[model samples]
Target chain A: MNNEKKKITMMFILIATLLFGLVPFILLTKRSGELQTGNMLGILVVIIIALLAAVIGVKRIKDLKQGQPVEDELSKKVLNVAGARSFYMSLYWLLAIMLLQPVIADILFDSEMLDAEQALGGGITGMAIIWFLNWLYYQKKGVN
Target chain B: MKNKIKELRARYNLTQEDLAKKTGVRRETIVFLEKGKYNPSLKLAHDVAKVLKTSIEELFLFD
Candidate 1:
């Protein structure tokens, strides 16, 4: 497929591989007390595999960045569309969360829930995650 | 908003990177200008025009 598709597929594959790699640990161990010695090697292997995959993904991105320019008219329009969608919708999502924060906190935690300070911290964290995700998606899919 | 970047670069045979180095803009900024994705600040436009050996009006088409 196209570069966008390839990037998304690679990301999905990486996530799936990571979750699958954790399955054995989840199944075999009930607690830290029950941890087995032999599983250490398995965990190490998973870490290495994850690192290798990350390296491959980063290399792919670097190649794209350094590759010949492709900002033809169509791509530029696509980028603008993508950007408009991402920014507007993502901000809308964030607004919804902020508006619903009290209800969510009351349900998810005791009503002693996050106050302004904690909420602000959590908001910043959420913003960072969303920004990173947006950046990744734009890099993958022409920002549209 | 105005620049003579492409023409100047063509005249000097300087790559975008070379111009970026001389003008202290990121390569991406240079690329952005070349592609017309952005209308840069007056300062940036002037700087680029000055480097490119052309007036801002020559480099940019302001509506």
Candidate 2:
């Protein structure tokens, strides 16, 4: 497919993924119990993903309207750099979370919160945000 | 590395958009290239040089 068509398809898939994420989020929130810190973090993650999708969609649409190719060599380079940076940063982030898990649990839950799922969720959310921000930065500042 | 892309493009009466289109890249890529902030791949450098009717060494000046 052409670049424009490819970008549009990618945007649709992102939106669809965001919608799919919301289904589980809604189901979890509707459970017959008070929302936990983990649940709140999950909701925040969804919101961040939705916002990222919107930002990317608007930028792609503007580029398309201006008859510019959305995917090009520079963009590919920026993406690669961003992905690498985020991956590296997320490793540190996960380590910090793991090391501070007991302190976090004491402060937030007043008990042991040794839930691997929540830690993994937080790591993934942090990685996504870091990747998005890095992409935006390199896109504007130019990647070498 | 600095390049003479802007000067060469002007000699050919080509705007950045036109050069980008001819080189099959985004205008932002051309903008970055002209500013010497981005280093293009061998393929992209060759393509841009070919479009401007110049050799790669002539198009991109290495400091």
Candidate 3:
């Protein structure tokens, strides 16, 4: 694989891993009276990691942009196709979540209806996961 | 999309940075166009092509 692809994939791996790693901490923060200085430190660390990941991700993306002389028709097609696929997939997720909100609220966890904050936290995290997964997957595999 | 931006920029000997500066876009957008990983908006396509002294059709090719 080319250096550009490698860098991008590495960035994705970093981001996905960070997301997965932070989930538990973020979950802990959702519980009332569970907050602590350590939790604050953890959040701070996660933010720092995310910032670093963004820098690397942006660099990798920028690196791809540096290849203008040979940029060609196939590249555009690949971009558009992948973009469209990611778009549709994420849109479907958005719609599905909207449609299933009540059922998901009822079936998944008992507190979903009572604790609006936790429910929203979980929902946001879930959606973000889906979004990032789609982008990473499409970027890696190309569009179907 | 196939672009003659490179060739035209070369004709004028404008670097990607120069073209990007002139076009009010990021150097990355210029790079993306060059790499064909980005398809610019019609307005952008026209603007770049015009600045480079080419037609949009000549600058972009349909798959």
The recovered share of true contacts, given per candidate in order, is: 0.00, 0.75, 0.00
Count of backbone collisions in candidate 1: 3
Docking class of 2: high
Local accuracy of candidate 3 as per-residue lDDT tens digits, A32-122:
6676544554455555557655764775576466643223343344456655665666676666666776776577543345254434444
Which window of ten consecutive residues has the lowest lDDT sum in model 3 chain A? A67-76
Kindly report which residue stretches of model 3 are placed more than 4 angstroms away from their true locations once superposed: A1-117, A129-144
In candidate 2, the second chain superimposes onto the true chain B with a TM-score of: 0.97
* DockQ winner between candidates 1 and 2: 2
Interface RMSD of 1: 9.1
* B-chain TM-score of model 1: 0.84
Interface RMSD of 2: 0.6
Model 1 clash pairs?
A82-A143, A82-A144, B3-B59
Q: Write the per-residue lDDT of candidate 1 for residues A27-101, one digit (tens) a residue.
A: 667465555433443454456556545654664566456652333333354446655666776677678768888
lDDT of 3 by residue, B1-63 (tens): 566677788999899888876776656567777877667877778878888888888888777
Quality of model 2 by C-alpha lDDT:
0.86
* Model 2 agreement with the true structure over B1-63: per-residue lDDT tens digits: 999999999999999999999988999999999999999999999999999999999989888
* Quality class of the docking in candidate 1, CAPRI style: incorrect
Best by DockQ: 2
lDDT for A97 (candidate 1) = 65
